[model samples]
Each structure stands twice: as structure tokens, then as C-alpha cells.
Target: MTAAVVTGLGVTAPNGLGTEEFWKATLAGESGLGPVTRFDAAQYPSRIAGEVTGYAAEEHIPSRLMPQTDHMTRLALTAADWALADAGIDTGELPEYGIGVVTSASGGAVEFGQRELQNLWSKGKEYVSAYQSFAWFYAVNTGQISIRHKLRGPSGVLLTEQAGGIDAIGHARRHIRKGFPAVIAGGVDAAICPWGWVPQIASGLMSTVDDPARAYLPFAAEASGYVPGEGGAILLLEDAESAAGRGAEHIYGEIAGYAAT
Candidate 1:
């Protein structure tokens, strides 16, 4: 049997971008819930969201792939980049075939899909980007991360709605146990746009409260529903032996066990 340990963590949350910053905020009991600014939520029933602030994709994403990816993909890419740095695994020095990527996405790329549809109707089919067909898929993150970092092990994507992120980590552990040196696994999503929100609203699981502070209350008597938000997390899972062989220090934690129904 092989041991799978978590060596790196990357996050893009409504409260923070990096691990340390996010930790501090969490410790302080900070709340990221506020008015939705990504678009006008005034006309919608739910007008608040836990949105990531101060995120500039151009600073984190490669310029070449900027126009080709949606905000969800860019967030995943940024998280992956930071996760690699956190693990001290330089992609250039690692064996191309030793690493892999696995991610989960519930919403796919609603923002990109919405834009493409608008383009087709407002302008023409030619005005729509060729990247939309692939970029809007749920598996785009896994594919993009694998290509950008040259990881060639076993790559895949999981779509289990809210539980998908946790499931991805479990699958990555399975990959490591099966002989892969390491795996990048996690989930991301951004469906706060009009079209995206409509479908989510139809689910009837979202809150319609006008006050951001009192909107999302889980397991509480005041619990109405959830406030939609954008952002996700990424983690680097490596074999314990491989991590020790490379003298990789600063391990955060370990996924000692995992299972799914």
C-alpha cells in the first residue's frame, strides 16, 4: 500500500487569495459576504455573494491563454500555479510524465458559454471564439493545467456538484497509490452571471435575502439558503516516499484516509 499526503495548497476564496492570508481571515472570523458586483443583482431575488476581490487574472494567468479562458478557468490556473510554488515542485525540473491533474467543476464555464451565446445572436457565429467549445467544458481545468505544466500522468475531471471538490482529492490519492508520483487535484466554479444564476435559481437552493449578513445560514433556524459565490481551491498530492526522496519540506498535512459513496 502507498501513502498519499497533501504537500501543497492553493486557494482563491472570497476573503483571500493565498493560504496565509486566507488563514488569517478565517481566524479573525471575517465574512466575505457582500453585495454582488460582478453583475447587477438588483433585479434578482438573491443580491449577495461571497465574491473574490482584487483578483486580476492578467497578473496570474499567462497572457496567451487569457482570452481563451473564462474567469473560472483562470481562477483554477492561478490556484494551480500557487499550489506548485507552495509544494516547491518546479514543473520544468520534474519528469513530464510523473505528474497529473484532476479537478472538479460543478458549473462548468457558464460565464464563457453565456458570452458565446450572446455573440452568436448579437454579432454572428464568426464573432464567437473557437475556444468556447472546449473552454466551457467541466474538464477544461484539468486539461489546461496538465498542458500548461506538462503533466502527463493520469488526468481527469469530476462533476458532483457541491461535493465534487472533496471527491477530486480522493481520486488524486488513488492515483498516487497506483504509482503516479504526484497529482494536482481540486475544484473551481463561477456561475454568478445572469444565465448561470437563472439555472441556479431554478434549483431553489439559493437564498433570496437582501441582507448579505443574514442571507446564508446553514443548519440554523434562520437558514434560508445559500449565497452563490465564485472561486475554488487546488492542492498538490504526492507520494510520501517521493516527497521524502526530494527532501520536500513544509508539508502542510496528509490525507491519511478517504472514501466516497
Candidate 2:
């Protein structure tokens, strides 16, 4: 069996924007949970959440893509770019068919869907963008990343909620074992808008406490429910032998074993 190793990481987390920043804050016991500012949540039962602060999409994404993509897709694209750069991958030098992408999503792009629906009802059906046809799909992240980087190898998207990220990585490893040299495998999710909140609230698993510190205490005596958050991570997964041949730096770890029920 070919060993799959992680060569790079890109993180857009509530606590930090990059891997180094996130790790430092986590070690110091810092918290990113706070009152929701994406929208007016005063009337909602859950008023607080972990939002990715200080992120300006304009800085990371091209202006042309702004109109077509949602908040989550933008973040995913930026994360994928960062991961590829971190891995020192020069797509121009490698065979495009030898690289692949596999990611996971939970709720798709509710923010974009909500906006399109508003336009449809307020104006007319013609006002809705054709991009809306695929923007809200759960596989949009994987498709967008693949298109952006021109990775023409085996690609796929998994939708197993929290376990989806791991499943995607496992699938990527399978592809690598099948002879692909490199793969981008991870997950990114952002559904912190009104339409997205509706489903989370309906699930009855969201924390109602407004206090950030007191909320989202899982497996504790004071545990209520959990706080919802936006942002996730992307990672570069490469075959171990191929990584060594290319003089790849920063081998974080290996996917020693994976099994799913």
C-alpha cells in the first residue's frame, strides 16, 4: 500500500486564519466564539457563534469570481490556494492528470441560494443567476477548486457532516494508492447566514446561551447544545514516495490507517 502524507495545510478558522496562528491561539487557550455579527441575531434563540473574523474576500479572490461565488466557496478557494503554495506545488511542472481534489461540505451554499431566491421572488425568474444552478450544490467546493487549479485527476466530494472531512481524506488516499501522485484533500464549510441558520436552529442542537464562554460546552455538566461556526481547513495530501522524489518539505504526518462504517 502506498503511504499518503500531508505536505501542507490551509486553515480559515474562527480563532485564526492560518495554521500557525490557529495553533498558537489554541495552545494559549484563546477562544474565537462571540456574538454573531454576520446578521442581526438578537431575535434568534442562539445569538452567538464562531465566525471567521477579519477576512476580506476581496483580498483573496478575483473580482470576476465575486459575483458568481458564495462566501463559503470563496473561503474554500483561498484555502486551496494557500495549501498548494504551502506544499510548494508548481502545477505547471507536474502532469495535470496526476493531481486530484477531494473535499466535503455540510450545508452547501445557503447564503448564495438565499440571495438568488430573493432576487427571483422580488424581481423575476430571469433575475436569478445561472450560477445559482450549481452554486448551492454540496459538491461546489470540489468543483470550484478543481476548475481553478486545473487538476484533472480523480476528484470527488463527500457529504457526511462532521465526518465528511475524514472520509474525503480517506478517499483521496485511495486515489493516491491507485497511482495518483498528489491530491488536495480536506473540507471547508460556511453557512452562517439567515437561511442557513434556519436549518441549524430546526435541528435543536444549537446553544441558546448568549454567553460565548458558557455556551457550547460538550460532554460537560453545564453542556447545553453547541454553537455553530463558519470556516474550515484544506490540506495537501501527496504520495510518500512521490513527495521524497520531488524533495518535498514539511511532511506533517501520514494517514496510517482509515476505516469507515
Candidate 3:
């Protein structure tokens, strides 16, 4: 029996911008939690969040495209580029039917949402950048990733709350098994800012602790609910035959098998 292989990995998490950074922080048991920066906390009940700090869009995003791409989409695209490069696939002319993208994400263009609302209330409709038309949409990450890579093959997004993280891996593995050759697979959730919390604030699933340590603690004795977070990751998935033929390193593991309810 053949196994699906991992050829590339990219991650943007509350810990850091890429897999290296994420790994360093994780190994040291670093806490990424903090007060939200995109807005003032004078009014919101939940002021603290797990914010990804020191990440500059310019460092990860191409200057020309940044003006048009939303923050969430930018993270996804940047991660995708790194993943594809790590896979050693020149996406400039990808195999027509072998490349695909399967990603999971929650709220997108959320920062955009928070800002656009301000524009509407303080400025005018024309003041809204056209990117607002779809920046925060769930499908934007998958769409932008596919477009950047010219995947031209089957592409999809998983919106199953936090379940999306593993769902994306399953999607890519299934696609590879079906003989798709290669697929970019992962999940991203970049909704930790202002508007990201509106629904949660209303739904009462958010934290109320002013101390970052006490806020959004999961699985602890003082466990509250989750903190809204924003970040992205992409892992390159390929058929076993392809990766063994090329010989890549840092192969984390395989898409062995996953279980769900």
C-alpha cells in the first residue's frame, strides 16, 4: 500500500509567521496571548486574545499586491507560495489537473470588516476599498491560493469551525489518492481582531478576563472558551511516487488516517 507524503510545510500561527517560527515558539511553550491591538478595549467585554505579533505584511506579502489583498488572504497566499516553493513545484506552469488547494478557515477579511464598518459610519460607501467586496469571505483564501498557483484543478474550503484544521488534510489526502498528483492543503483562521469578536461577543462564547493569562485559556483548570485568533498555514501534499522521486527533506509525517465524528 502506498502512503501520501508531505513535501512542503508553511504555517502562520499565534506563535509565529512560518513553520520555523511556530516551531520555535511551540518548543519553548511560548504563550501568544495578549490584548487585541486593532482596536481600543474601552468597551468590549473580551479585551484579550491570542494575537500573532511582529508579523509584517510587507515581509510576507508582495508590496504591489498588499494594497488589494485582505490580511487573511495575504497570509494564505504568502504561506501557499512558501509551500509550493518548498514542494519544488514551479507553479508558473503547473500540471493542468494535478494541482489543487484544500484549506480550512473561519472568519476572513475580519480586519477588513472592522475597518470597513468604520468607513461606512464615518466616511461613505465610496470610501470602502473594493477589496471589501470579498476580503472577509470564507472562500477567499482558497480562491487566492488557487489563483496564485494556477492550480486549475479541484479546489475547496472547509468551514467546520475548528474542525476545519484536520478536514483540510483529509481533503488533500483524498485528492492525492484519487490521482490528483499534488495538492496544497491546510487551514487558516485570521479573525482575532475587532469584528472577529462581534458574533462571539453576542453569542457569549468569548472570554472576559482582563489578564491575558486568564483570558481564553483552553483545557486549563481556569479554562474559559477559546480566544479568537488570526493566522494561516499551508502544507504541500503529493502522491508518494512523486516525492520519493524528487527526494525532499523535513518530511514531518504522512496523511496516515484521520478519524472524526
Of the candidates numbered 1 and 3, which has the greater lDDT value? 1
lDDT of 3: 0.79
Looking at model 2, residue 88 earns an lDDT score of: 92
Clashes of each: 0, 0, 2
Model 2 per-residue lDDT tens digits across residues 153-177: 8999999988888898999999989
Candidate 1 lDDT for residue 120: 98
- Per-residue CA lDDT of model 1 for 109-143, tens digit only, reads 88999999999999999999999879889899999
Which stretches of model 1 miss by more than 4 angstroms? Answer: none
Clashing pairs in 1: none
Give per-residue CA lDDT, model 3, range 60-88, as digits (tens): 77687786677778878878878877777
Worst 10 residues of 1 by lDDT: 89-98
Deviation from native of the Cα of residue 258 in model 2, angstroms: 0.9
What's the distance in Å from true for residue 181, model 2?
0.6
Candidates 2 and 3 compared: the better one by TM-score is: 2
- Per-model TM-score versus the true fold: 0.97, 0.97, 0.91
Q: What is the RMSD, in Å, between candidate 2 and the native fold over all Cα?
A: 1.0
